[model samples]
Target: METNSMEAIVLEAPGPPEALQLRELPIPVPAPGQVLIRVKAFGLNRSELHTRLGLAEGVTFPRVPGIEATGVVAAAPAGEFAPGQQVMAMMGGMGRTFDGGYAQYTCVPAGQVIPFRSDLDWAVLGAVPETLQTAYGSLTEALDVRPGQTLLIRGGTSSVGMTAAVLAKRLGITVLATTRNEAKAAALKGIGVDHVLIDDGAVAERVREIFPDGVDNALELVGVPTLPDTLRAVRKHGVVCFSGMLSNEWIVKDFYPIGYLPRGVRLAAYGGDANDLPQAVLQEFLDAVAAGEAVVPLDRTYRLDQIAQAHADMEANRAAGKLVVLP
Candidate 1:
């Protein structure tokens, strides 16, 4: 049912945002154990920014930039999915190892094509996969957040941070979300964050003032530069989760002695992937979105021609929320 070719954003070479070019690509067909998705929308991730700058080492040029997509299955294996079923694909080498959903159609591995029946729009679905999965997986697998627990979210203005706040709040956990700009305090509060703290390099001290006993858990979205403060804010036996590196610092130059870590304090990290994103978590998130219990903050939508603008917006930190590209 496809035409000879479809429009797509092709990354011909690694460079600035302008490297993305609109090209007419033949509609992709599914191979054995692969599913062809007629992509309606896809979300942009900071990792995509890294991939574009060739920061993702060993990635060759002429790649696609999207990591997740939502749409109907154009073709899938028998008994796997029928044509036109609502589905989403994420973090299974979609945009990394192969051509991804920067086009009108994309072929994804069948195992990674998750089918979800929902009334959610394409943009919402596109926004859900990476953000919610990462947040939920980190919260559950890494932090194990629970009711009555006081948690701190470092880099709380980012999409994953906001998602963690919502999921944590919904689970009866008290969330202290952070922002470098105090101006976003009100905005953070609007999105179910119980409290908003300004991250002014004194995050540990600020948390201590709020909860002198220290918080039960902390999810560090910012990297190593801020992880020390995040760990310091946690009580003995409390957990600190490192999930993202928005601060661009990947390594801890000063590896302190084992005793330097708080006694009995546990450090955990979650890297989201196809396996990390359990169906139960996706269902819980989707049901929340459907019931209006969770707010999926969609920033804006852009056409394929606006791919550069999308990347620029994300790189400049101008994206206030999740940004989706509609094809």
Candidate 2:
């Protein structure tokens, strides 16, 4: 391969995991206000999965797909970071609008590439971007989890769910994490969560048995199908942050009808937007992980060539935590 070119996973036409073709493409040259990233590692997010399956609209063909990444600055117009300085970025129309992080090199808007300072490895840091951002937003922005409060993680095994559980526990919050997989319950408890509940359809019933008043906050990672149970698990006036749609159902019909909502319960939602995450906040979160104050568990690592297998494991429910791809 030419020195100016780099390896990348390109989506010629959205289809199955096999459509993510590994090819040698010319490395991107940063335009003014943008920096060329020597992507060391990138994460596989559900948004990319949806795009690769042709589920996302407005996606032109022959595009590289990846929403979040962690790496060093290869080239940049004189700015806040020197070449080789580490950085990370998520959303910001990364994979959806143009070429993103599924490559050895990516050109990102300078404003979007957050200077992430941490001594963690690329694979470890790569696990932090999207998962940490979403988890932090849901905990601090939406749920406002406080010390001594009780929290519920509906999709306990999902990346967001697990991250939220760990952050809440660190804040002295009692977390009641739920998972449909009974075998995973012990793993949840080992993560410092106060309790782990089997996520059967009777989640509300089980929760009520443990805490009669219900949990103080709930992070509903699942979608419409589990929202009702999640609502019932929260105490009156408590908050429920409706985040990911693990069930693949985006909207709930008649969700606004008062009867379906828990009395005095508040609803909040989390969506990925580059601007929504301030640089200082992102830095602080990464600092905590670097200091061992919070945990962002990484499940699997794949080479750029094994991109298809990574997506396959994610879709098969085999990954117990975040999946990172080393480019």
Model 1 RMSD in Å is: 1.7
Task: Evaluate all candidate structures by whole-model CA lDDT and list the values in order.
Answer: 0.84, 0.84
lDDT: worst 10-residue window of model 2: 270-279
> Candidate 2: which pairs clash?
none
User: Which stretches of model 1 miss by more than 4 angstroms?
Assistant: 257-260
Model 1, 74-145: lDDT tens per residue?
Answer: 887655889989888887787778888788888888878777888888888888888988898999999888
State every prediction's TM-score relative to the real structure.
0.95, 0.95
RMSD of each: 1.7, 1.7
